[model samples]
Target: MEETILVLDKIKKSFDGVSVLNGIDLEAKRGEFITLLGSSGCGKTTTLRIIAGLESPDSGRVLLSGADVTDTEPNHRNVNTVFQNYALFPHMNVETNIAYSLKLKKKKAPEIKKTVAEALALVQLEGYGKRMPSELSGGQRQRVAIARAVVNEPEVLLLDEPLGALDLKLRRQMQLELKRLQQTLGITFIYITHDQEEALNMSDRIAVMRGGVFEQLGSPAEIYELPRTAYVASFVGSANILTGRCAGGGDTVAVDFPGGTGSALRRDWQGREGDSVTLAVRSENVQLLSSDDSRGIPAAVTETRFAGGMLRISSKLEDGTEVVISRYGIGTDLVSGDAIRIDWAAENAVIVLPDSEVAHE
Candidate 1:
């Protein structure tokens, strides 16, 4: 059985009468890398901070390994945070910075030295003990920050956009490194980030937040493939949305999209024909068929761009709604203004709702 390491029961937090976290309930299992993925002001970082004890909740409870820690001080909680800025002491070298936490515990020189050295080795900075933060690259500095946090071996770890400062390639590299470190350490990592790609790449589970509540929570595959909400569908990745409501008796329904009427099969959706709904399909899943293989729907190719790995073509329906289709591999025969059929498999299309939308109970 997987043990629940952290639990938030109806957690609420407000500032000056405006609520930021509106009754958030979530759980993190032991040794899981759970990411809070959302845009700014969506309460992701606030929730992470609440778990860290940096801010006391206005209501609700926080449990750490089944112990109530809502009133505990930041230092007393079994969680450590790595800030976006790395938060290293500008005046100290790598060794002393990591040793600072141990020294606060009053450990002797031999013990602190061993712990710091081992921590450095864990982050692959074994020989950088004498180097200052300024002497190291951005990635290395971030590693030292991780080493500092991991040296304590807390029950949980928190990272707040720690790689936001790095470049694209470095960010990708760090995401892999972070995933590896989490597995090797077996610590529950509660990461918070607004980057969808990074969240999908590094997390065992992802909680999509919107308007101070979790829109949906599941494994990366589940959230990506089986989004429970329209906000999540739009937020997680590129989803071409079509709005309509259920048409009776069976799962097959005729959806009214901006483009045209289309056949879509939805799974267990609780909606009536008059009830508004949205359909979501990924661009990559959309197949661009040749004119000979065309559907009855009229569409015109408006633009095309080569994305190195794939050909991205922008199309417009007769009704003038934009549809983007990404075709894999080499195919340069398409020209602007050419007519084509942009169709996706009925099963590949997803139905979603906006933030204000409700789900079936």
Candidate 2:
């Protein structure tokens, strides 16, 4: 059985009379890497702070390894945080920075030295202990910060966009590094980030937060392939959302869109005929067919752009509904203003709630 390492029960908070976290409940398994993903002011950072005991919740309980730590002070809790700025001391060398926590505990000099060396090795910076912060690159500085946090051997590591300052390539590299470190060290990590790709690539499970609450929570594949709401589908990746109405029923559902009527495999959706529904198809899932193709809906290509590994084609249906499709390659024979047809398989079309329903739910 997987052990529950952390639990947040009905965590709620308010600041200046405005509710921020509205009853957030979550459980993280031992050694799991969980990400709280959302835009700014989504309460992801607030939730992390609450867990770290940096801020007390207005009403809730935080349990770490089954011990209630909601009222505990930040330093008393068995957790460490890695900030986005890599908060290293300019005057201290890497070795001294990593050993600061141990020194504060009055640990012996030899013991602190040994532990710092081990921590440095864990982050692959074994021989750079004597280097000053200014001498290290951004990625190296981040590693030192991780070394410092892990040196304390906390039960949970809370990372607040630690890679936010790095360039895109370095950020990608650190994402993989953090994932590997979590696995190798077998530590529970509660990562906070607004970057969807980082959460998708690194987390064992993701909690999509919005308006101070979790909109959806699940594995990356689950959230990507079967989003529970339109917000999630649109937030996680590129989706071509289309408004439609249910036209047929049974094993499959026929939906009438602005472009045309299409069928989709119905999977326990309890919608009826003439009911408003939305269809979400990933841009990559849409196939561009020839203008003469009888099975496709007629559309006029409005624009095309080469986006490195893929070609993005934008089109407008007869009813003026815009649809975008992505094809893997450098270029497409079709160009702007050309009459084309677009179609997708029934399995690729997902019936979603209308935007209004999504908002209220």
Candidate 3:
């Protein structure tokens, strides 16, 4: 088992008399990559700040490598942060920027030069050390920032949406680079980002935050395949949330949605008959058939569009609930106002408990 390197015990914080981080706990394993994923105002940044010693929690202790660092100064903690902005000193060239931390520690000049060279090489910026920040591209600047942070050899690295400033293509490219850097360094990375794709692509585990608390915390696959709440189902990916009630229960539960009935695999919850439930099915899981086919719920194709090599079909149920289905390949013969039937395998649909039901349990 991996050793626990960082622990946040019941950490709570607030600003301006408004609660930001409602008591939350997280355990990060050594050399693990964990992401705090949520939208703005979700307290992800506040959590990162607390861990970095940039902000103190109103209550709870922060333990780093089994040592209580709740009151430790930012510079005293063995952690480093890279922000959305590169935060590189414009006046300093790449090598100088990366060597600044080593210089502060009063390392021998020879050691600092060697370490800075290694850091630059790790970031694939070997000969660019002499180049100023202004001369580099956005991606190169971000790489330089990462090199600077990793030069400290901190136990844990905190990244706050480091790719947010880059364009889409660059952002995707940096995601791969960041993951490679983390695995190569064998350093624990506590990253923060609101992009779902970024979180899913990069994190070993994700803590989905909302209203200052975790909506769900698990592996990317677990969070995507087995979302615990409707919000998670919707936020993590493209899920069609269908309102329904448990018509019957067993290995498979029958749910009656508006104008149709569907079956979903039974999960951890032992729901009773007639209990209100929500069904979450991914767009890819939904299949569209001709309306003449009687095997599924009837819907009308509201819109169809081609994007990212996938054909996205939007339809509305008889009761006016919008359902979206996605299929690979560009262009579909189906057009707007065409009649269609939507269906999915029983195992593909997930039954989600209502928020109140989940909260009461």
Error of 3 at 66 (Å): 1.0
Superposition-based RMSD of candidate 3 using all C-alpha atoms, in angstroms: 2.2
Q: What order do you get sorting by TM-score, best first?
A: 3, 2, 1
Candidate 1 matches the true fold with a TM-score of 0.90
Order of all candidates by lDDT, from best down to worst? 3, 2, 1
List residue ranges in candidate 2 displaced over 4 A: 318-320, 359-361
User: For all candidates, what are the clash counts?
Assistant: 2, 0, 0
Error of 3 at 46 (Å): 1.2
Q: Which residue pairs overlap in candidate 2's backbone? A: none
Where is the poorest 10-residue window by lDDT in model 1?
352-361
lDDT of 2 at 228: 70
Per-residue lDDT of candidate 2, residues 194-224 (tens digit): 9999999999999989877787899999888
Which candidate ranks first by lDDT, i.e. highest?
3
lDDT of 3 at 130: 96
Model 3 clash pairs?
none
Can you tell me which runs of candidate 1 are displaced by over 4 Å?
258-260, 289-296, 318-320, 329-340, 358-361
Of 1 and 3, the candidate ranking higher by lDDT:
3
